[model samples]
Target chain A: MTGIRRDFQKILLALLLGALLPASAWSKTVIGVMMPGNSAYFQEIHQAFLTTLTAKSSAGTTFEIIVQKPFPDPVALSNAARKLLAADPDLLVTYGTSATLAVLHEKSHAPVIYGGVYDQFTAQLAGPRATGCGFKIPLTSLLRHLRELKKVETLNVLYCSLEEDSVRQLNELSELAKEQQLTLNRINLKNREDLKKAPLAKGDAIFLTGSSVVAAMLDEILALAKNHQQPSVGIFPDRDEAGITIALYHDPLAQGRKIAEIAAQVLSGRAPGDIKPEALRNTELMFNLKEAKNIGVKIPFQLVAEASKVIK
Target chain B: MTTTPIANSRIICRVIVLLLLLLAVPPLAFAQTRELVIGIEPEHNIFTQMEEYGQLVKYITEKSGIPIRLTIMSRYGEVLQRFKAMHLDGAFLNSYTATLAIDELGMAPIASPVSLAGESVTRGIIFTRRDSNIRRIAEMRGKSIAFVDPATTEGYLFPLALLKKNGITDIKTFFSHHFFTGSHASAISAVLDGRADLGVAKELVYQRQVAKDPSIAAELVILEESPPTPETTLCLKQDLPADLKRKLIDIMLEMDQSREGMAVLKTLGLRGFTRADKADFNIVRQMAKEAGLPGRTSKRQ
Candidate 1:
């Protein structure tokens, strides 16, 4: 009877240890990150996420960060997402609207954290396991700065016709312009050549939307803006120097940290759905004084003083 | 006994929560230690160049409480690339690079170095050996010329536009050979060494070199000079926090007021830094357009 009781106790202890071992013994967490491109902004998000996760993991959870090669288009992004999903990562992090959509399309049960997206709601990325930061350039703020920069009777906007985010931003701007009683000229850019051929009237300020095509053709567009002497405003903070008179955009590092915080919450056993998608809280205004002068617009000293950076 | 088990379970839960809190705190604290990175284009021996700006870097860091790192890019193109990559938080850029950063990177100029003469404008000078007979711009046709990188506003674009205005429209046809020596000093050295009959460089650089070595003035004669344009600017990436930006600008603009700050400015060959306005670089953009060169050039040559 004594021998039997001792054997029974040993079996019960083994069962308890087996139940606890999976939680305590599992040392590594695998995270797969998909980025639209290997641009500096995306890299900042990636680095911040890894640094935050590694430093925060209290369980000494080692992480294997698998970064998919950057994809240029939606199709490439979808394909890369499929490959990353096949590896069965513990979590998925994506940068940009297109990349996040690609991961969502895969229907992977893994939690998805995204950053660098302009409008997550319009992108329709709010799935049960998806939540991250979105940078929606406040039109009111942009228009206010425009008013300060120039007395605008007409506001010209250039966007890529095919990009949903670009169109959405254009529509939003149109509504805002209507409320302000400002005339908005919407120019649809189909290709790089379209930017060069676009007719920009004098005394019209151009507004740049969050369009990949427009971002790619920024150089030509700025050159065109210079030639036409058109004062332009852009949503991309990074391209402030690219000839846009003003750029209102989010801080990439801050955005990265926000996404990392969400990732940490998910790692702490909170479902992604428990976290609401956050809009960019930190908006930076950059003034290109040189571009302003080239376009023949006078910036008020107050506006210049308010700028986060002034490129003179 | 049942109540005791429930209490023990609650204690276990509290311990677990405490452990989670402990783990999360350090990383969050570490993330707050932001780094301010500055990119300086490699114009000379990088070590010496860094040493020159070391005091300024220290002063900025001390004032802002943010650690600063200065990255010297190997070429002008690299400097633009780093800025575009958003790898740099701030930069000391030439007028052309500063203009491009404004247009392409949305970088804002905070301040610019003021010369001892109280002028922040620098002009381009086309020079040749005093003994050379290439007196007129047209006379140098089919002769070799050396210019600092094509990205330079004063050293290349402005002077190149001047050449074009003087009826040298086609460089290939007008000059037998042309190359970029990569730096103003190198371009002047090329002309002095007879490696190239004509060289273009910033007048400020030439003057500084002549001041250090008077023989350079005797050997090189100015063939033509371009109009005064904005000097090198200290720029910051637009995405930085507004408070940090203001602090940085204040520290830089007021650097001359303090002895330590003046010492740092002296090392950088400047009297002090003055607030830069956008109109300062209008001539640079105009010259770029007039030169028929793209406002932003990827190639250094």
Candidate 2:
């Protein structure tokens, strides 16, 4: 009889233990922000986002932000995202198309906040769980500025055919042009020498997207622009020093901070899908005044006032 | 006991109905708050213009939590159309457009552009193809000339006015052909391309072109320069939030010293922002009034 009583007591203790556990453990929200491996801009953006998260979080509800460098291939980005998902993060933060796509592949149950993406609808990146900021680099503004600088009918963009990032931009700009009844004349140069030999015609403007392949030929490209009397504009901020007339770009650090805020909102129990993806709230338009004079194009006062930086 | 049970059932029903009502009303009230959209035309040539927006966006958003979506329009006319449609929450308009936006569209100027000299002004210049024999404003008659956007101060307003004031009333009669190239850079390029005999543009833009392509630079000569016009400015929507306005002004005033904030400011090309009141635009208002221009009405292209 006593043995039976002991078993009953043990069963009741076990039942009580099970009942005492929380209805569900309050989760540690995990935020994964994927970025490029070799960029100070990306680093600064990541650090700023993390700093904001640290400053904002309160006691009891802890959050973790994972900054992953996706290098070599897009698949690497996917793999990193999957690895992050294994931890069951409450939310995901991503930047640019490459990293954003990688996270999308996982089809994360946790809400995903995206940042640094340019034109979500055009890029087809507005996923079910994805909502954050978009890259608001002024494509129309850049083109219009180019028009004001000079009436170059054909804009020749030097792009690496293999790079998905450049290809994505090439496609976006292509679509953007269609809406405005404009044309982007493309010159696919496989090597530096080929870029030099790309056919130059009347009414041509050379536009360089930030590609290492193109960056390798910076001086040569500048020389080509000068020789043809064609204005060259790049999309990278750091490349302004290399002689591109203007660069409509933004700080990746600010981008990261923006995405982090979205992530924080998700972690704080706001629905990710409910949180609309934000476009880059801040952007800087940089112009090399020396390069402008070199290209023989005069800038308007309206444009000069709009520039974030004027490098003379 | 029967009365007690009936009363209890009624009370329970009331409690249940009240719970549903509470759940429905709070969310509906929250949804009623609308988003204010601000349109920005990215004038990337100058940092101050870009920085002003950054400071303003941060200030306004921080204060009101309202998201500002920048609808980048290409030409000056596009902005006017949007303003006419009452689509803009606010806009950063140039003096020419500011005049039009104010006089015609009811846009109130809140700020204006300034230079290192602390003078809020810029000018337009007419440049001729170096090979063209037209060397002076009088000689420009019967020559092909290109003007940038009609709303452009340097590109259109001041340049055209210079011709009108100089007794060359009809550009078409004076110039063999007149064209609107839509921007100062294009105006200069028309001459470089040999498509136009003369071009009207902003002086600094001309300087930038010369710096970029000396060959093109060699092909142009400054034929005339116009008097200065007020810098472009932030003109608010008719009903901008008072708290948001205060926040934007505060942020603009404080932007220079804020470490993280300055980077965004530096992106938009300004040294630093200072406070300006409605009276600051008295010069522009008086100038427009003197020009026989309505507050915001634009001279058609």
The residue ranges of model 1 lying beyond 4 angstroms of the native Cα positions read A1-27, A37-40, A58-60, A68-73, A121-124, A201-203, B1-301
DockQ of all models, two decimals each:
0.01, 0.04
Residue A134's C-alpha lDDT in candidate 2?
A: 64
Residue-by-residue lDDT tens digits, candidate 1, B150-173: 778867887778977876778888
- Give the top-scoring candidate (DockQ): 2
Best by lDDT: 1
lDDT at A293, model 1: 87
Residue A269 error for model 1, in Å? 2.2
List iRMS for all predictions: 22.2, 13.4
Cα lDDT of model 2 by residue, B135-251, tens digit: 877786666777877676667666655666677656667777777766666566556544466778877667656766554555567877766666667777645555556655566
Candidate 1, after superposition: displacement of residue B130 in Å?
A: 71
| Cα RMSDs, all models | 34.4, 31.0
Worst 10 residues of 1 chain B by lDDT: B24-33
lDDT of 2: 0.65
TM-score of chain A of 1: 0.80
Residue by residue across A176-281, what tens digits does model 2's lDDT show?
6676566677776557678756875543788876454565567887887888888877666754387888777766676777777877777767877677665542
